[model samples]
Target chain A: MSGVADDTAVVVDQVSKKFRLFHERNQTLKSAVMRRRRIVADDFWAVRNVSFEVPQGETFGLIGRNGSSKSTLLKTLARIYVPDEGRVVMNGRVSSMLEVGSGFHPELSGRENIFLNGSILGLTRKQVTARFDEIVDFSGVETFIDQPVKNYSSGMYVRLGVAVAVHTDPDILIVDEILSVGDGAFIEKSRKKFLEFTGQGRTIILVSHSLPQVREMCHQVAWLDGGRLRAVGPTDEVVAAYGASIEAESS
Target chain B: MAASYARELIATRELLLNLTMREVKGQYRRTALGQLWSIINPLATMLVYTLVFAFIFRAEPPPGDPSGLDLYPLWLMCGLLPWMYVTRVITGGVASITNNAGLITKVYFPRMHLPLSVALSTGITFGVELGVLTIALWIFGGFPLPWLPLVVQAMGVLAMFATGIAMLLAILNVHFRDTQHFVSILLPMWMFLTPIIYPISLVEDAAARAGEWILQVYQLNPMLHIVEVFRALLYDNRLPGAVESLAAIGSASVVFAVGYLVFSRHERRLAELL
Candidate 1:
């Protein structure tokens, strides 16, 4: 695993996000006119005053139990969710493999989806063309490359999705539970790609429930609990603290 | 802030192009006739409307055409070609963000691109429709060469106006699902009011007895100016009057500016709302 460098790539400073929960699903004008108004159930904070920094060219991991806001934090970093308070500052092009095949159209061929998904992930057509063979090679879906993606097996679909995402070559990659899917061989292949990604001196912010995986890949880790950052330090220390807290809670 | 947004949009032009391609290709995919439907759909609409109005209602074609062409169908198509673009933009644009809730929530991109690409895709289909119109002109009106530029200019204005409305509705639909339902109801009403099937002269004749305000408001319809420009170029072989051209371009610019403003303002909350 690589150690943290001095330069900062991503900084989340006092960021927070609030979600509105309505008493009724009142997003339609008909209901609003009929009822004459809306009733608010509550406004809940999804992430609150959470702050962290990932150094340039290092892997940062976020490990948390479910509902701990790890995914929200990762999304905030990806710029998918705008923070309700404070801000996230970043110095490089960010691509979130938040969900693979995000913009894929089932009617489009795999060859076409590769171009579409590549651009959706922020690559230009020329860039996609240059890396076309490698992407096909990585996905191992070459025989069906020209077929519409609807015909691809589920396993083939995900592998192609992952293959395109990693090829985006972003300065900062935000990954959320992507590795947990796919067959064992594909998972191993994806890990090798991540290693190659880190080898190129890029930053990665990983959100996963896999503590040991985090401990192995990331130099620094932050543990989130109930929408707050509970621990941040070297990976082993934070992961160990999170593990102990889990044991204590169960006992 | 809007300038910077425009700059970013331009910088990400590749994404825009690719997405537009996706829209155009995805639209015809899985259908048997495929891309031919683009031309056939409008041609069929033109034939049906021409049958009803020209044959049944006996609406007069333009007064001075020696080409032996039945002027009503040509005139109707001249107006209908751009109308297709306008309606598609409004309905497609309104649903653009909502339909792509999957992508909007999962990934971060300029939300404006969805409506823009949708507008542009329809614009591409509109191009094919124009080709059909040009062929119709060759057979029916003998293909006036000098008047072609005017037709192209009117098409550009229509595109700008439609894209603007699309951008505004796309974001609005995300916040209120009622927008989707409202837009469908609004489009046919909008089409009837715009004078695509009938000539403005009929409305003017009605205005003399009803009141001048009737014609004044009818003239104020931005699409009225666009359809008039199309009729002027393709049917009458002339340029749109200065006032007509000004009205069409000016109204289109205003709509585009307002739509861009509304879309960018609401873009941040889109993922959350979706």
Candidate 2:
């Protein structure tokens, strides 16, 4: 593994992720054999030769319209998708809250899911146990912690999931517009937690459609268009360039 | 590569343990009989086999050689329980990657842990079933308590073998969804091919009449030796034949190695594929 500078938090070097666009899924023996091959699809590069770097303690935003593949790039950084080209090097431990409840088992209780979700985010049982009370209290679902998450309201469920995810204590946090979870007060509380995250000099890689959120929270921003990096700079400049492009297109 | 994979596997031990616990708990969350179903399922199948092979067909195989006990259901269970565990692990493992697509696509961990944890959870259920069967063997004066250690060892080897096959097919199933369905239809054929319902003596007899090559081809089936190992330890209260146990370990290691190599080759693409 190549080492990055201590001042650099993340380096995305010429990363590209290819996806298969299947015409007809060849998911049966009959189809596979009759076709005389595994299913073949058109090669589509979702993230194309995108390169950027994040300095330590910088809250970076990936801003793009729908279908720009910013989310794919984030997934690549999170190790969910191995880049077909180039590499991503991170200097610190990373955790991604990609979705509100990515790893929750509906049949398990809220308490059990806290441990399970925490484990999925790379926290050990002992680490999760250490913050068990804080996670539960943050979620405000202590009344129903023992009940299966299937029975909890969607809001309650998302709160518990978010609670477990944010508490994993990663040096670099990845998010996909899941920060504003639950009702008004919980959202405010979680926002404060994220503020504290940046105050602690942690880096965050955020992919969001909300330009205001990006401008408000991000120090640096990378604008993506059609799976390519359009512009990258301080938050205001990139956000303005992205906004003008959207306006030009809508007109 | 293998060293790093093994090291990461060790580092993620807690995740593996929790995944196994989730599998075991999720399996019986709302069931009426709960964990007893693991035992009852085998017993029911044993009763059916005992009736069909021992009663209706009037097949009277030789008793356990040294233990000197002869009961149709108990003898049938000695092999049947292990076979059932094989079926459960394979079926569960082949779908481990595809079934957990939500988790796989969203979060990242060591992907191999999915199938391994499934195999381990199946091993837990198999352990319970084997414990009950061993106790029942004792009740019938089979005296397998002395061989309990060997039973655990046999289970571990069989689980490895099953997990290997599972991991290999799981990648296939992701590419060709029909693999699961195809394996389901083939399982009964596999069970019949093994010596669970009938003794290996019958196979030997057929081989004698047909050709020596017949038995040689039959022995190529690893499950036949696996079943024999269990029957030797739990049913006969003796060590498995030297060659038979060696074959079991050899095939298990080969399969596990192949499975790991193939799975690692394809594991990264699984998120995109799924």
Candidate 3:
């Protein structure tokens, strides 16, 4: 459509990542000195020749089965893992809600983790201070903010993480199945926030197994099968193809 | 490349500050004694060492010095304070990457900030402990007033050197879990090699023949110069002559450079390794 859209927020050009599976990790002095070329059992390409362009303000859904390179592709896009080949260019502030409680320290209070998670998500101290009340209210963990997060129930933890991520105001947001962690009410709240974020012209890349949600939320969708792109296009067409493939296999 | 690293560091400074505060608070949180335990840990060690040397061994003060200062505890504390801080930072630093696997795997901040935050956290404790020692010195009337800057400078040098080493060790430990065990064995031997327990002057007197060569080799160990600088500032009036000070600073800078280089080089693999 219009040859690579003018407002491209993220561009991944033929990116690939290979991880060598070592039979025995040879880090010891004796093993290193012996130098009998340690075995490489296999080279696993976690993301192989994956390419896509996400335009600014677009809601892009990445749908795939488990071990289908969805998470790996997100990580590479997030710059957590460097691609072994090709390149990824991003023209905005990117924040990933890869794991809901990724930055929470167990011994820290919910209030402390708010600042921590906010900072990790690239919000400055002044920014977090200004939005502190909004974040706490959004999470609905107001009364227990001073208590250590170790005391937080699973529902509270997920809610707080989502609340922080939403409030950080990143230009490019990546959500990886984090919505599945929280309660039903929190999920509804998260969806509202996600819609608001996208409405404000922020790019959102969502990786979820829920095909119906992907079809509803995404303008475009990409399907990954075994570390390779199976199909990518309008959400309805791609999802239908993915469904057909899955049903045929099941039959 | 350097500018990018510095920019990345500046970007993550907030995270470093928050993590450091978390570390300090987490240690004392829910504890009966709270922050006092930081002071108590080193003081307790000093008491045991003092008892063994003064009562059991019947050790005496420096010859011909009628000040009657029980300098053993003072000497022990001087060396022990910095040594313990370094050891704690190094040991805890390794876990900085491994323990935060969740953050490393998910987030895209400079991973060097993790170990650096640990070093900075320990550094706060070291500063507090130094304040305690200052009061102790004043109470004993053994304050080396003129050399205060030198002692402070030595502590700063040692802290920076240790920060560099800790950063390197943390990245390595993520890849090779055995580094943790190797460090446990290495620290004690490192202490013995440094003139921590016995002064370099004492060792020199004990072995006159090969003492110069041994002392020169000892100088090669950066910590030896650090401890010597500490002793010079606290006990002796001024820093070692300009030549020795320059040598020590040069060695420390080299180690720090190497450590940072190694840490930054390997940081990319930390997520996979962890």
Candidate 4:
């Protein structure tokens, strides 16, 4: 799938992120002051020195079981978490679809949210207006577009969120376990959109728990285990290796 | 990295505008009074303040120097509106980050924009309040059109100052939940310390009686100069003297700079902590 032309889009160069496991639930200054500084905490490295590269136009997938640090790596790529060690370098505009309705105001109408959410994603008002019709059409929530988003059914809310994020028109997109939430029709629509996105020579980094879904979509995959990359290669090979490792552990 | 604050601000100006408008639109929705609350709330404050000082205490602040108008409500508001602006802006700023922890965590944006938009939205409400006060001043004081530009300038200075404080407190509030609670307690007390209700002459007289150093300590209040500046322009219809202007703008700039520095240092780790 990704053998078209080789140009690197994202490079994760030995990046590591450390998360602190706090000993106390205190988030107030009084306790911190009384304690002379910070509360007791143990350092947990969420992701170790894991490195990988995605060629331009490649649909790359990160597959691992729960607590495998796949989502942390994805977040590091999204610029949500600053890597405590090493760095991540990217060659294109990056947008992360971590959550569907990130900046949506509940009281705002869907039509208003389109503009508000678009602006939050750094799109100008004019750009949001131009793509306004396309977004509404894609989401298939024309009737509720003018109604407050709080009134929308759960499916409608997610579908609209997906539409805005998909239309951000980024060179690189970071997705985190969101595709599994939408209805089947919407998920199919999103799948087709990703294919079209890759056809334009853009790159996508998806973090998913579904192995078959990853095999169906991504050309390459990285399997993370306990904060390190256990395997990285073609989708079928790496997924098979990951499957084997799972069997070995279980048996 | 936020390479340049000005550059980042320029880049995200549209987003700032949208966020500010979001606050403005969301604030008054699902209510009967709607946007009218912006005007009514301040007017109500004026009514209570007038009842307390003008009626009970019989506090007669100096008539406007040139306009020769002696309306207590107008003069009180000229000072009180700016005070309220600072208070509201700071509260919005302190809560800006914590309140939007959802948006901040899910998306990677310039976190500075949250407090900034809060200040700006508070500024909008302040602008509406000032407009009504200006209109009232005109009705009683023969139209203060000549001093309107200075009023606008003072608003800008106060806004910059308030936003700086907001930015500082917002990041701090992220670390200390008590910050928001503490600030709510301090603001009303801060208003009393600033001389919004009674005239500065009352404080001057008290200081004169207590000791001259008390006057010095009392004068150290930045809001004193700032409120006086607002009073001088809007109520008294005069320039805020070169020294007053310099003092007001200077303190505001310093607060803003410190706010910027503190906020920038803690910005990157915000997503993790929150």
lDDT per residue for candidate 2 within A1-251, as digits (tens), equals: 36778888999999888888977754667876777775677999899989998988889999998899988999999998999999999888999989977778889998888888888889999999999999999999999999999999999988988898889889999998886557888878887888899888888999877787789889999998888999988999989988998899999
Which docking band does candidate 2 fall into? high
Ranking by DockQ: 2, 1, 4, 3
Better of 3 and 4 by DockQ: 4
Q: Which residue pairs in model 4 clash with each other?
A: none
lDDT string, candidate 3, B42-154, tens digits: 98988887898656865543421222345778767777788998899888887788888878999888888888888888988998998788667657866566666667787
Chain A accuracy of model 4 expressed as TM-score:
0.95
- Please give the TM-score that candidate 3 achieves against the real structure: 0.94
Best by DockQ: 2
lDDT of each: 0.86, 0.89, 0.82, 0.89
Write the number of the candidate with greater TM-score, choosing between 1 and 4: 4
| Span of 10 residues, lowest total lDDT, candidate 3 chain A | A32-41
What is chain B's TM-score across the candidates, in the order shown?
A: 0.95, 0.97, 0.90, 0.97
Candidate 1, chain B, TM-score (2 decimals): 0.95
Tens digits of per-residue lDDT, candidate 4, A71-137, equal 7788788877899998788877888899998899999999999999988876889999999999999
* DockQ comparison, 2 vs 4, better candidate: 2
- B1-274 in candidate 4: lDDT tens per residue? 3458668778878999989989999999899999999999888999998999999999979888877889899888988999999999999899999999898888888888889998889888998888888788888854678888888889999998999999999988988899999999999998998888888788788877888887788778888899989988888888888877888999999999889889987988898888
Q: Which prediction has more favorable TM-score, 1 or 2?
A: 2
lDDT, candidate 2, equals 0.89
Better of 1 and 2 by lDDT: 2
List the pairs of residues colliding in candidate 3: none
Report how far residue B265 has shifted in candidate 2, in Å: 1.8
Model 2 is docked with a DockQ of 0.84
